[model samples]
Every structure is written in structure tokens, then in C-alpha cells.
Target: MSTATDDGTREDAPPTPTKKQRRAAGIAEEASGGIKLILVKLIGLGIVDALALYAAFVLVMHEQWLVTVLVVAVAALVNWIYFSRRKLPAKYLTPGVIFLVVFQVFVLIYTGYIAFTNYGTGHNGTKEQAVSSLMASSLQRVEDSPTYGVTVVERANELGLLVTDPDGEAFVGTNEQPLEPATGVEYDGDLAVSAEGWKSLQFADVLARTDEVTALAVPYSEDPNDGAIRTPDGQSGYLYVSTLEYDETAGTMTDLETGVVYSDTGVGAFTAEDGEQLLPGWQITVGFDNFVRAVTDVRLAGPLVYVTLWTFAFALLSVATTFFLGLFLAIVFNDMRMRGRKIYRVLMILPYAIPSFLAALVWAGMMNESFGFINQVLFGGASIPWLTDPWLAKVSILIVNLWLGFPYMFLVCMGALQSIPEDIQEAATVDGAKPWAIFRLIKLPLLLVTVAPLLIASFAFNFNNFNTIYMLTDGGPRDSNAPIPVGFTDILITMVYKVAFTGQTRDYGLASAYSIIIFLIVAVISIIAFRRTKSLEELN
Candidate 1:
């Protein structure tokens, strides 16, 4: 290689490696890397293969052929990719991309799909399954039928009741075939105790599975209208008939005793003329009815508006209070003259260091209305409802949230403050600018560029901070005025939770609509806030 002197003369000085020598060096380095890569890939892929095999077996058993096929295919693809000598970029990205698709993309898509369907507590399964469930649940004992001696048995991997009529004729039947005579039998007594094509559940096994035994219903015949045999007590089976009859051709359930025909309402349930609904309704597509109900249903709409307002208030106040308090502390501690600054900073962050939910629980205990530390010890037994009174409970939540949230803001503000050049603040001081004016005009705007996005995130987090609200008050100080499952302190998220779980109104579709609303609110607000944040960046 040669280099030009000041006069631009080039001179050849030293011999460089030939192309073949360079290629050899590259090959040697690549060979070393290849061995290490092979070992890592083999170990990782082996574990993945083992897990895939287990998952495929489970999926196959569940009759989920598509998922089973996909799992096996993914395992094969992974092996092929890692074993190949190409696609370096794909090798690095494969794991993260796969995980993102499965965990995030799939979940969001499923939730969105559920939001559009009536997939709640009652409306959970197919129409056929729901009809079967209704039929099974509505069974009544046949009083005039002959009493049969019975024992619980297994046939074709299904539980059945082995029975014999008053004459001691042996029969083995399941819920699907309530009374089919046993082909092969060895009578132990008048009970006709032993039967072929059946494996008797031992007396000990019956004792162990009391719930299963009680739930067991063996059909008398393939025709459900023929009635079934149910063994309430393990020793004997009773002939039972369903009061409601399902007509497959008509797609209707008829009450046998009452003669009331319940036709499919296409509203996730079977309904009669009087609007009586059958229990355990089927899942159905409802279009935008869930969203429509959220906005138009009398029970939900009124409480939802109040909850949305409170949600906004709670999130805004949380962000504002925490941010200002954190900024104040950050400014105070940022001073070089402050004593034990590091210790103070560490003590300040202790709240953030502990889990937020745990902190919320501790606060809940401290702020309890009756016989609490705040009421008894601090207030001298005043019975001040820190968590019960509507306005006070709201205040209490804000105070608790501030305590839990400010530490995070403090840490972020402290970091952002330190990043600001000291010379800029010093220049303002030399220019005779007052502390407040300088902060408002210069330092604050600069700090925002770093912290504004976090503030927006904090607001979004507080908007749906379910744990804090739940563990603290469980969204209480009940709004008895409204019929819906809501409270004065209830935010939209907490109210959705109540609608889905805590009360009888386990309407998951409605809850999901509420969630989609929340998502839109957060997404819009974030977009606007981030857009405004761009100005802060430009200010810097």
C-alpha cells in the first residue's frame, strides 16, 4: 500500500495480503462462528421441538387439527431455517417475530372478534352444544318408570350407568343411551352386577368423585324423548325425562309438559313469545349491538358516562399532581448545595421500587373506614370514611396514586434535569433572570422534550389502573342510584370489570365494547399528545 505525500506522489511500500489469503482468513473466522452457532441453534431447537411435540399431542387430543398442524409445521420450519447456511437476517429475527405474532397479534385479533360476538357467561358455545346443555339441565325424574339397580361404569371412554330392571336383566347405558341391555352379563345377585362392554367404577372411585356422580346422566335410549337414567345416589339409577324437547329440523325447543315452543331469537338465545329465555344461550354474531347497548342501554349508558368522566378526571389529576410534585423534588434535589441528595433520592424511589399493587393494598388497609390506622390512630377514632364517601374516596384514590406514581416521575425528571447542560441555566442566572421566570421560559420547555412522552404514558396507564382501584376500594362507594353494577369511584375499566365478573351481569361482550372504547380514547389522546410532543422536541 502507498500514500500520497504533500506533492501527491504515490509510492508502493509494503506487500498486502493476496485475495486468496484474505479469502482463507474469512473462511477460518466463519468456520469458528459456524460451530458456535450450530451448538446454540441445536440446543435451542431441541427444547423447542420437545415443547412443540407436547403441544401437538394436546391439540390433537382436543381435535384442533389446524393448530396441531401449524405447531408441527412451525417446528419443522424452525429446524430447516437454523440448519440452513443462509438467511442471516431471518435467523436473528425469527424468535421475536414468532412471539410477537402469537402473543400480541393473535390476542388483539381474538379480543376484537369477541367484542363483536355475544361470547359472555350464558352465550359461550355453539347452538347445538347449548341445546344439549339445556336439555341435560332440564331433566325431571320419571315417577312411573321401573326402579333399576345400577353402578357407574366406563364405556368407550365415557361414563355410563350399568343398570338392571326389576327383573334383573342386565344393561349398560351412557347419557347418550340411557337403557340398552347388556349383551354379556355374569349376575352376582338380583342386581345383575357384572356386564360385558363396561368397566365398573370402583366404590372408592365413586366416593372420590361425588360431584361427577351427581352430574352423571345416562340416557335411556338414543331418543332423548325416551327419558334417561340418573344416579343421584351411587347404588341406584332413577329414570328421568327432560321437560323440554329439542327439534333439530325446526331448530326449536318445546316444553313437553307446558307445550311452549321456544324459537331461536337470533339474539344469542332461545326465547318464547313472553320473552322467556332458555339458560346457557349459544354464541352468535351481534354486529354492533354490544357497542349499541353500551351507548343506548338504560342500565349501562348513564353509569358509563359518569365513569368515563371520572376516568378522564382520575388520569389527568394523577399525571398533573405526580408530574409537578416530581418536578419540584427533582429541582430541589438537583441543587449542588443539597445535603445527602443521593440518600434522599434513594428514599424517594422506595415507593417505585415496591410493586404498585402491593403498595395499593397497604394503602387500602391504612385508609380503611372502620377501625383503621388513619381513622383510629391518626384521627382519634373519627370514623372518617377515607374510602367510602364518594368525594373523599376519590380524593383518597388520588392521594394513594400520587404516592405510588410520583416516584417514577421523580426518577425520570431527575434524569432529564441532569441531562440539561448546567451552562444554559448559569447563562440565565448571569443574564439576571429570576428562578421562576427562567424555569418557566427555558428549563421547563427543555425538560418536557424528554418527559412529555412519559407523562402521556403515565396518563394512559392511570386511565386503566385496575389494580390500584380494585385493591384499594374495589370501585366502591356504591352508586345505588343506578341499576348497573357501578360505583361513584368506578372508572370505565373498573365498571367493565364489574359488568364482566363481580356481579350477575357477566356480559363479556359489553365489557369488551367498553375496552374498545377505552383503547380508542387512549390511542387518540396519545396521538394528539405525541403530536404536541413534537413541538417540545422542536423547541430543543
Candidate 2:
């Protein structure tokens, strides 16, 4: 290119840039890139720091000191690693390590810990909390108790009662704080309407939080025997005393009316001589009791055994049925003579395109015994009891799962089939082998070589197929005779879910134990299946 010189004469520019000029241009580009990279890094680190700060704040508020420290430390380490020029590998590996620990290692460790404890409803708190809960639940109004004028107050989001005693002394108390003499107390008639640093709730506020106000029990003193003050209407406070007295030194609770002393037997609860135990027990380690209960407890053993067997059958059969059907469809459509192959392939995958959970729900409606599409329309109003009967429910689940699962297998098999070298099949044909012989000896083995791992994965998925079983039958056809609410259709996962969440008394420890067993079972099966697939690898 040419440029006009200062004298207005056309002159040729340098044919190539000088080394110094090129070096200067390269330096400028590198500087701009460095600035952009620094900006991006700072923005990324800022977001990470903000999230870490939030997580640390939450952990500290929950008194999880160790976790809060870990969060802060991790965030600091991340910032240091990214900011440092020397730690290139660390900057790349940090995210994966963090995610693996948070999502995998932590979950496995927590689940294992829960499996060894009685961390369920009524056994979810510390001993002190349990004692307090027990005492609060057993509170009864003192006979001939004089009503004190009360005003509901709040400070720092905590509800308190401003009480005017019979002698006209004003006191303020919250759930955490015992009654103390109030300063700067304002009165509306005899009622202690307000106190310093506390906002007296208006009638509307009291009405809005009626449940909270009514449930609030403010201690009259630090001593449990002294009782607490409670209000029903937020306007009148009554002295409600606990019927049980806790002896801290003895670790015993005495029923005042019955003169019965219940002592802590180290079984997590205050137990009486007659084998009766108090509710709201503290959590305790039970060693292998939960695991033992699953295998040996008379109430759970029979149902669990049946559920385990059924789970195996369901997973195995689901894999078999889906694979064969999908393989057949893929083979038929893969033929060169088949017209509109793309359209057929698309139609075949339509079921796979819908979300599994939604499909399960739709199938659940279709299989409804009375009003379902299957019984009403397909069977011309026949009452099949597809979900209610035990055998029939199993059949219904298998059918629905087959429908939901086959399309995925079909897509996989189609790709594998199409990828097989055409020359091998032609050579088999030229060798005068029958079609069945060629497929049986050549195609099926090769297909299995590619599809074996997928088959194992499919089995694992169907084994934990909670959505299909849950949405379809909800593990119903209830086995009332069993101790817990189990059903004929319940798989191991569904059974664990029911034990943990569905009933009035949730046994999270037992559920976690079941979950551990399930994990072990799946892991073992997968290991064996993968080892077996080594033979298939030889075919490749």
C-alpha cells in the first residue's frame, strides 16, 4: 500500500513492517488481552466471594462453626489460586474438586452418619431441647391462677410478653429470656403496653400472629420448677406450671401428680419402670439396630423381602423387554428398502421426547381402574383393577415402564446398528450364511459390544425408578397387617421413602440404612456387570 507523504507526494509504504514496529503492535495486543483477562478474573472472583460470604453467613447463623470455617477457607484458597500466576493446574482443578466434595463426598458421609443415629421425628434434637419440649408440652394452668394483664411485644424478630403483675410490677420476657423487671415500661391502664427497646404489637399484629402468641411460653425464672407464663389471647397472661419436674443432677423427670420418677436409661428417652417412655426423645447412636431391624424385625422383614425380590425382577425384566423391542424396531427401520426412514425414526422417539415423570403421570391416569383410558376406552368399560391388584399392579408398572423406556433403547440401538461396517454383513451374505445365522453370530454380538454398558446403566436406572412406581401406583394395595405402612407394589426405594417421610412417625435412621443397603447393592451389581462386559470388549 502507498501513502501520501507530508510533501503531498505519493510514496510507497514499507513493503513489510519493521521488526520494532511489529514488536510494539504485539506488545499492545498482549497488554489489551492481559487487561481483559484481569477484568474477567476479577468479576468471576467477585461472584464467588459473594456466594461464599452468603454461605458462610448462613453457616455461622446456624452455629455450624466448622462448616463456616471451611467455606471461608475454600473461598480464600480459590481466590489465591486464581490470582497467583504459578498455580495454573490448581485453577483448572479447583471447581471439580469443590463440586465433587460438596455434591458427592458430603452426601455419602452425611447419609452414612444418619444411618447410625436415631435422627427422626420426635428424636431429632439434643437432650436439653427434648427436656424443654417435654416440659412445655406437659404444662397445665395453675389452679386459681390470677390473670396478669399482658401486652405482646417484639424485639429483633423475637416475640415477648410484657406482663403487669398483681402487685403492679412490670416485667418483660421472651421464650429465651426469663421474666425480668422492666425499665421504661409504658402502661395502658393496668396492662404493661410497652418496654424499652421493644415494640408493642398492635391488635392487628397480634391477630396476624395469633398462633405464635398463643404458643409462646415465657419462663418465669431460670429454674424449671418455677414454671413459665403463657398467654391465650395476647391480652391475658396466666401462670402455667409443668406437671413434671426435671432433676438435672439425677437426670430424672418426676411426674408431680403420679409421683412417678422417669430416669434416662441411656436409650435416648426418660423411661418409667413400667416400660413406658417419654415422647420427644433426643437422638442417639443405635449402632446396627436399624440395619438389623430391616432384616430381622418381624413387622418389616416380610414386606422388605418381597420388595427386594420385586425390585430385582422389575429392573431385570425392564432391561430385557425394552432392549429386545428396541432392537427389533431398529433392525426393521434400518433396512435399506424401508421408505421414509427419517419420519419413522422420529415417530419412534416421540415417547422418549416427553419427560419421564410427566409420562408416568399420564400413564397413571390411563391405567385408572374405573375412569382410565385403558379400562374405559381400550377395554370398553372393563374394570381391570390394574393398579389395585398386586399381580396386576406389577404388570401395569412393567408395561408403562416398557413404553417409557424402549424409545431410548431404540435410539441407541439404531445408532449402533447404523455404525456397523456394511462390508462385514455383505461378506457374511457371500459366505452363504442364513439371515438368522448372520445376525445371531455377527450382528447381535457386535450390538451387545456397543450396547452392554448402556444395558447396565438402564438396569441401574430402572432399579431406582421411584417416579414410575410412585406416580403409577403410589405403592398402594396397602398391607395393613404390616407394622409400617408398606404395600405390595412398594419397591425398596419407595419403601425407604415411606419409612422416612410418609407416616406420623418417620424413621430417618431406618430409611438411611435402607438407602445404604441400596447403594451397596447397586454398586456391587454394576461392578459385576462391568466386569462381565469385558468379554464383550473382546468382540470389539
Cα lDDT of model 2 by residue, 355-381, tens digit: 888998999899888899999998999
User: TM-scores of all models?
Assistant: 0.86, 0.88
lDDT of 1 by residue, 1-540 (tens): 787878889977778889999997787557436767679878999999999999999898778999899899999988887777665557778999899989998888777888899988888888867876788888988778777788878766777777878877777876545477787776767876667777888889888877888788777766666667778777887788889988877878899889999998688788999999987999998989998998899877788888889999999999999999999999999999999999999999999888988998999899988877988898998888899899999999999999998999999999999998989989999999999999999999999999999999999999999988988888989988888768989998899888888776588888888889889999999999999889777786
lDDT of 1 at 471: 85
Residue 359 miss distance in model 2 (angstroms): 1.1
* Off by more than 4 A, model 2: 1-58, 86-89, 144-149, 155-157, 164-173, 176-198
Lowest-scoring 10 consecutive residues by lDDT in candidate 1?
A: 28-37
lDDT score, candidate 2, position 421: 97
- Model 1, position 2: C-alpha lDDT score: 85
> Model 2 lDDT vs. the true structure?
0.91
Judged by TM-score, which candidate is best? 2
